[model samples]
Target: MKQELRKQFGDEFQYEIALNGNEALEVVDELVEAGVNVILILSDWLMPGLKGDEFLILIHAKYPNIRSILITGHVDESAAERVKREAGTYAVFSKPWDSTKLMEAVRICCNKN
Candidate 1:
């Protein structure tokens, strides 16, 4: 799925493949160390090892400059509200996503001069 998006975007974007939350964090850490500027992050809410909001919290603690969009279907409204309050989530999407809206939101979030 993401591969197709990468193909569509071409050199306008780059991607890192990670098997899980820990791996994703490791990749993020490396990017931060290398001074790579990521304008936005879109992450799934449910993942092995850590929830999406939890992982985003960790990333936010370290890299507050990055914006985050969370996708989830495993939680209720109360849980979503709590996550938004506690985790600084920029936006949330329900599962079975809409690709057009997602891409538009991505562009809005990642816009640079």
Candidate 2:
């Protein structure tokens, strides 16, 4: 997935990978220290530790400017609403996402004119 994203985004964007939410937090910290401003996070809902929505909420609390997208195969309506209302996510995509739509969301959320 990272490779695919890297191929799509190329060297224009910095990408970070983590095994779990905790590691993701650490990576975010490292990026901040390294003077890299995070623009977005694309995460799976069934992550190892914290769920995607929960993780995004956590990140939003600290860095409200950062945008988020949740990609999951299973999502309840109420959970989706909660994440949207609470996390301020850019959008939610089902599994086997459409690359064009995903990129469109990214552009809309991160670079709206």
**Relative to the true structure, how large is the alpha-carbon lDDT of every model?**
0.76, 0.82
For candidate 2, write residues 7-111 as lDDT tens digits. Answer: 666777777888788888888878888889899888888889898888889988988888888888996677677778898987889888998888888767768
List candidate 1 segments past 4 Å from native: none
Q: List the lowest-lDDT window of 10 residues for candidate 2.
A: 104-113
Worst 10 residues of 1 by lDDT: 104-113
Q: How many clashing residue pairs, candidate 2? A: 0
**Candidate 1 residue lDDT tens string, 28-112:** 9998789888667778878889777888888888888788778887756775776577767767888877877777677677772
Per-prediction TM-score: 0.84, 0.90
lDDT of 2: 0.82
